[model samples]
Target: MSTESIRPLIGISCGDLNGIGLELIIKTVSNNKLLELCTPIIFASNKAINFYRKSIPDSNFNFQQIKDFTRINPKQVNVFNCWEEEVAITPGQLTPEGGKYAILSLTAAVEALKAGQIQGLVTAPIHKKNTQGDSFPFTGHTPYLKEAFAAKEVVMMMVASNMRVALLTEHVPVQEIGPHITKAAIVSKLKLIEASLKQDFGIDRPKIAVLGLNPHAGDEGLIGAEEENIIKPAIKEYKQQNNAIVQGPFSADAFFARGYHERFDAVLAMYHDQGLIPFKSLSHGEGVNFTAGLSAIRTSPDHGTAFDIAGKNKGDESSFISAIFTCIDIIRQRTAYRENRANPMKKLTNRLLANAVDEKIEE
Candidate 1:
């Protein structure tokens, strides 16, 4: 298939409908300009959409409801009813029904993703507490997706305009983070980070900056020993195994403050807040959460469902829009990456073309 003709079908899960999930989806797809980039398939019921459509009464967004994937309109926003039965949707109210339907939409979308019906996924915010059930008992999307796809490992990386930050330990208690920061986990995360940068982001050689668990990188072992015992050894082991550029047990405070993040293509933090705090501060509300090392492409807004502004037509769609764009870009990049690997002649042809251009330049 020609690259130009291959428009990815991006699936979006309507998160806690009571929250701002439906509102954000409506606002994002309202722009006809977005339909040109990728086909958006919203996994939501018609009832849920109607609730938010009435709340935000000014949007011109419309959806083409399809019962089958083959009937999807590539140029129009599409909605696939995950459940046909009626479900109550009270915007700004938290209830079990909100979580139940959120899981239903997510489950339907994930099935499509696995069957290759969708090329990528852009998830709206879901209430982590209410999203729990027998089907989904995990803390958040990363773990749930990891189990669903049977992926060996995954990293939660937040992408902003300036830099990309990944977490070594996600959604763990502060006291428990110390125990989870082992040499094996750090090394595994490093491998995943390097592979993701090259394949997903198109970086030939990505330099990753790793942060210390304690203050001032353990202050040469005085402050803490995680840097000396676990982190430093892990970096050394990773360097010996791969040629990818890996550096630091740098103090998190100074690394971000002094703009050292710019020196590397991505940063690896010890825990969630350590990386996310800096990323969100500089993201300008355009950050996207990307799960790396998955079998499929998935991205979500860095922020959660803003229940405080639910149904008020006050939610900003910038981050959600950025998530869609990021998911599409990654899907395209992954396709090109796989194709080049499958047909090595393409790489050789490109190298010959480069050398020819260099010779002409010299002349």
Candidate 2:
């Protein structure tokens, strides 16, 4: 309710109509509270939504479709029709039409974000192979976003609940991670992650723990040299930053095993398996994947579209629900933070806090 935050209109992109993207949207959109919090505008076709409504049972929705981007009535469902024709949707069937709209929806979301028409975007899952056909140059949402945003540093941090893990490397083969490790890359990625935690998630002073590149964290130079050589130095350099205490080079197995995982704000894993393994194990069906270092707030469910269970009325809503809630929270936080920094009084208060933290430490 603070002046810093405004009710933002979220541009929701239906990933692939055939996938569980449609199902998740159908399930989450039924709740009226979501409509009240922020305007829900589909960056897809009226045909697609309607098609989904008809194809899938238990879907109770009537979207008021629109042709262009405009301020819409809160109660009525608004859609910017990127594809008006019927997308050939056979459950789990991948077609050029499906690829076309998937890109169309993504394009619409990007345009809406760039134009400042929508405050944030919540994207559904899109299959890399199916969507790109043969031109699947980028990996996934996070990388594509990084490229579009002109991001110098980017990281995919999956947050389902209290357990949060940021990947130093994502969507890459296990073999590629070792050669890619560099001090600057580590420093830059962590800095972006730190800023995002405070700016987007409202973590005032985010304390992050970094994971080691090797098993047993190099075990005094026995396991691997990267931990003692690269990760340790990067953590040391970042620990000097204000309110950003970088603690890491810990054993991946031991780090998330105990309740100590709750102590820090976020964890930085050395590689994909090191981070996602623990993250998925802990957060499974209930987490949301947030792409950091983009121009606008973008979030998605951590899980993928279950091709096998596409229309069974059996897909769990935990990840989808979490994505919606996370989008709401991030948009609000970004709005609030921007609003607060705009006010001289609030800015001064923040400055004082930034400066006073060290005093408490000395005391």
Candidate 3:
């Protein structure tokens, strides 16, 4: 390997052993064509990966286990066995074994990414309920990755091909969205979205379309003040700080209409349902969930562990492929940003750092 040409070591975290994580892992790693792009390492138990292959019966993947991340070669499916659970790993069974194994695999993946052993991360879905049974504080994959990296700031961005969408507030109820929708939150999310585009998506100038909280942009505060009071103010502040093409508090319905997608880079949704409903409707089973504002790159399938269909061989791998592709895109941009002298974050902002600290202290 040449020092000048650094190949990205991609680490994949196997989620629920009972779910499609294993299936997708088999399909993706075996596809001879894709494996040649970079080195692929699975932070999972070899036994579990082999057990799940019976469902796909004729799968052509070779699950080769490796001891260290650095020792991985570009031509093989290098796996790091982190699963210490002794319980028998079975197909379509939600055992404590599955829960324990998922946690182990995830921890190994996080360490690899933090240590820079891998340039990108692609995590499969893990059953939150199954994990919690083993005393794990698992809400879902996005939040887990957010806390794993422990970034002072973060937002969940969903991507499907050319369409990109981000939620300002995720995993919160509709009623709670009113109180949590603060000026700083909106401003922070917009800044992160813009920076992610320029840093991870390789956009010199990103055009962001902000979605309104209320119908028809609150009818000018007649129905709701969140749009006029919160959304507009946040957008204006973001524009003052960033030179990117940041515009709109577009109504939810209108944003997806009128072919505005061709003009914008991404959409900053006001809340979980408002943003995800449209995104999932069109891109579900095919989208990738990327957690931004972390020190390292993080991405996963936009769906969760379909427990009912575990090991059924009916699980779609489109979203998982999206995750792999998203990581590739992010790594490419990061690599280019590092090699090229023209980078936006050449200097650090102590004031912003202090503000982030103060915000944490205040919270």
Best-fitting candidate, scored by lDDT = 1
Best by TM-score: 1
CA error at residue 131 for candidate 3, angstroms: 2.7
lDDT of 2 by residue, 73-113 (tens): 66656777776666677667666666667877987788888
Residue 348 lDDT, candidate 1, scale 0-100: 59
The 10 consecutive residues of candidate 2 with the worst lDDT sum are: 354-363
Writing each residue's lDDT as its tens digit, candidate 1 over 1-363 gives 222265679999999988988899999999876765678999998778888898788899888998889999998989998889988877888999989889889989999999999999989888888987676889999999999999999999998768999999999999898889999999999999999998898788899999999989999999989899999999999999897689999999999999999889999999999999989998899999999999999999999878888999999998998898889778766766776789966775544533443343234
lDDT of each: 0.88, 0.75, 0.76
TM-score of 3: 0.87
Deviation in Å, model 2, residue 229 alpha carbon? 0.9
- Model 3: residues with Cα > 4 Å off, grouped in runs: 1-6, 90-95, 132-135, 342-363
lDDT winner, 1 or 2: 1
lDDT of 3 by residue, 1-363 (tens): 231143467889998877678788777777665564556789987777777777787678886788776577777788888854554756677777777778878888999898888888898878766786445675776666677787778878988866889998887878888888788998888888888887777677889999888889898889899888888888888888775577878878977776576578899888888878788877746888898888788788887777777777877777876687678667766656655546546424322432333343233
Scored against the true structure, residue 73 in model 3 reaches a CA lDDT of 71
Worst 10 residues of 3 by lDDT: 353-362
